[model samples]
Target: MSPQLGNERRAADGVHSGESGRFTSPVRSSRLSPLAAPAFRYFFVGQVVNRVGSSMAGVALAFAVLDIDDSASALGWVIAASSVPMVVFMLLGGAIADRLPRAVVLRGCNLVQGVVQTATAVLVITGYAEIWHLVVLQAVAGTVFAVSYPAFLGMVPILLPVEERKAAFLLIGQATSAVGILGPAVSGVLVATAGPGWALAVDAATYLVAAGLLLLVRLPPGDRSNAKPSVIGDFLAGWAFARHLGWVIPAASASLVFNALVSGAINVLGPVIADDTIGSEGWGLARSGQAVGVFVAAFFLAKVTLRAPMRAIMIAFVVWCVPMLVLGTHVNVWVLSASFVVAGAALSLLDLAWNLLVQEKVPEEMLSRIMAIDGFFSFVATPIGQLAVGPLAIAFGAGRVQLGCFALAALVAAFALTRRRITDVRLTGGPPPQLTG
Candidate 1:
C-alpha cells in the first residue's frame, strides 16, 4: 500500500481500539469529585437534611419509649433491639455497596426509613404503639440503616477528589452536628405538644427530601468483583481486612468498646437520668449543649488540618472520659450539662480524626466493607453494653457501675493510645495510594 493509505488504515485501527476500550472499561465518569464539582453540594445538603431528621426522630423515639416503659431495663431492651441488626448485616451491606450504585442504595435506604418512621407515627397516633412494636420497628429501621450507612459513608471518596476528601467528611460531620443542635430542641417541643408521632412525621418528611436530593446527584460505578465471590468469602475478606490493618483493627476496636459503653449508657439511661436527676427540660438542654459542643469542634476541625492523627485521637478519647467521670460525680444538672457539652465537643473532634484516618488508610473499593466492619464491631457490643448497664448498675450499683465503666474505658483508651502501633499514624498529606491497577 501507498504511505498515505497505510497511515489512514492505522488511524482507523486506533479509533476502533479506543471505542472498544471505552465499552469494556468498568470505571465510570468521576465528574462529581468532591473538590472539583458542584454535585457534592447536593450530596452534602442531602446528608444535612437526613442527619437532622434522624437525630430528631432519635430523640423522639427515646423519649416516647421512656414515657411508656419507664424502667431502665425495659429501655435497655428497646435500645438493644435497634442496634442488633446493624451488627448482623454491616459487612454484607458493605459488599452490597461495593457491588451496586451507591446513590440507588442510599435512596432506597432513606425510603425504607421513611416508611418505618411513618409506621411508627401511625402506631403512636392510634395508641397501638406497644413497647414490643417499637422494638420490632426499630430493628427493621436498623437493618435498612445498616445498608444505607456504609453506602453513604463509602460514597464520599467516590464523590470527592482524594485531596479534598477530608474537607468533604468535615463538611458532612459539621452539618450533622449543626443538625444535632437543633433537632433535639425542636423534637422536644413537638414531643411535648403533639406527642412523638409529630416528630416522627417530620423525620419521614425529611427522608423524602433527602431522597429527592440524592436522586438529583450522580455517583460513579463501584468495584463489583464480589458478584463472583460466595457470601462467606466476601464477608471473610471484609473481616480479614479489618482484623489485619494496623490502623483499622485498633481504631475499630476502640470505637466498638467505647461507643458500646458510652452510647449504651446514654441511650438507655440518659432519659431516666434526665427525668430523675435533671428533669425533662434538662434532657433537651443537655442534648443541645452537646450538639453545640460538636458544632464548635467541627468548625475548628474544618479549619485546621492535623499532622498527628493518633495523638489527636488519644487526646479526644481522654477528653471523652472526663465528662463521664464528671457525670458520675453528680455535680447537679448545670454541671452535668456542662460535662455533656464538653463530651460532645470531644466526640466531634474524635470523630473527625477517626474519619480522616479511615478515609486515608482504607482502599476505596473496600471502604464500605471496612466501614461495615467498623460499624459492626463498634456497635456489636453496644447492645451488650446497654443490656449489661441496667443489670450491672443493679448488681454493682449505679455509682460504681458508672465509675467502673469510666475507668475501664479510660484505661483501654489510654493503653491503645500509648501503643506504638496506634500513636504513630500521621495525616497522610494526600489520599493513600489508589488501589486500582
Candidate 2:
C-alpha cells in the first residue's frame, strides 16, 4: 500500500448502540450522498486534490532518481531513506494523534510536506539535484507522513456519521481511483516533456491547497480526557489491546511480507524493467490501468455487501501474483497493463474489507494507536526490502527476483488462510469482539 492507502482509520461513533457499540441501521441514501455534508465535502475535495498530486509524485520521484543516477540501488537508497523513518516514528505519531486535534495535526504535517517537496522541486528543476538531495528531502517528507497518516485516518469518524462512514470511504476510494487514473497518465506526459521537477512542483502546490481547504472543515471536538499519562503509556495500552487480537498481528505480518517483497519488486524493479521495454510513458499507462481497476471495484463494492470479507481479502492476495508474473516475464506493455488492472481490483477489495472490519471492531478512542501498530507492522520491513531488492536484482536478475517475490506473496496469502482467527471472523452487527488478556 502507498502511504496514502496506509493512512486509514475507522470506528463506530454517534450511530452505534450504547455500551455495545453496535451499528444501528443507517438511513438509506445514494452512495454519493455523503458529499452533501459540508465538512465531508471539503475533506473529499482536499483528498482528491492531494491524491492526484501524490499519484503523480510517485512516478516522478522514481524517474527523478533515475535521471540523476540510473541505477536501481540509487533508487532503493532513496526509497529506503523514506520508509525507515516512517517505520521508526509511526507509533509515536499514533500516540500524538490520539492526544491532539487530528485536523490540526494533519494541517501542520501538510504544510511541512509542502515545503519539503517544494525544496525538492527547486533542486531538481535547477539542475542541482543529486541522489543525496532527493534522499534527504524524501526522508523529511516521510517523517511528516508518519505523523499525518494516523491523523488522516482518525479524522474520518469525526467528519461523518456512523451510517455514512462506509459510503464516505467508498466515495473517497472512488475519487482517489479516478485521480489515480488521471494523475499517472498526466505525470507521464509531464515527465516525458517537461521533466520530473514540474511534477514535483504540482505535488507541492496540491499540498498547500489541501492545507488551505482543511482550514474550512469544522469538526466536533474530540474527547481527550481519557488519554493516558504519557505517549508511551498510550502506545503500550494500544499494544496490549492489539496483542490479544488473534487476527491483527497475523494480518499485519502478512502485510509486512507482501509490502517488503511484492511492493518493492513493483516500485523499484518494475520501473527498471519498464525503462528497458515500455519506457516511462508506457509505465505511467500501466499504473493508470491499475487505477482503472480500482475505480471499477469501488463502484461495485459500494452497491453490494461482502459476505466473506477475509476470504475475499485472501483471494486478492493471490491475484497479486499475476502482475508479478507478468512483470517477471517482460510481457508486452498491453499485457502488463492488463495484469495490473486485475491486481489493482484485488487491492481495492482487500483494502475495503480490511478497513471496514477494523472500523467496526476497534474502539473509537483506540483507533489511532491500533492503526499505528498496524502501520508499523505493515511497513517495518519495507526499507529492508527496498534496500535489498536492488542488490538481489543485480545478482539474480530482475525477472528471477520478481518471480521470487510472487512466490513469497502467494505463500503468505496461503498461510493467512489457515488461521481460524482470520477466516472465522466476520463483520458482526453487535459490539466488537472484546480484547482478551
Count clashes in each candidate, considering only residues at least 3 apart in sequence or on different chains: 2, 0
Error of 2 at 265 (Å): 0.4
Candidate maximizing TM-score: 2
Residue 104 in candidate 1 has what lDDT?
89
lDDT of 2 by residue, 348-379 (tens): 88888877877777766677888888899989
TM-score attained by model 1: 0.87
What are the models' TM-scores?
Answer: 0.87, 0.92
lDDT (Cα, 0-100) at 261 in candidate 1: 71
- In angstroms, how far off is 389's CA in candidate 1? 1.5
In terms of lDDT, model 1 sits at 0.71
* TM-score, candidate number 2: 0.92
Residue pairs clashing, model 1 = 34-160, 256-378
Local error of candidate 1 at 298, Å?
A: 2.4
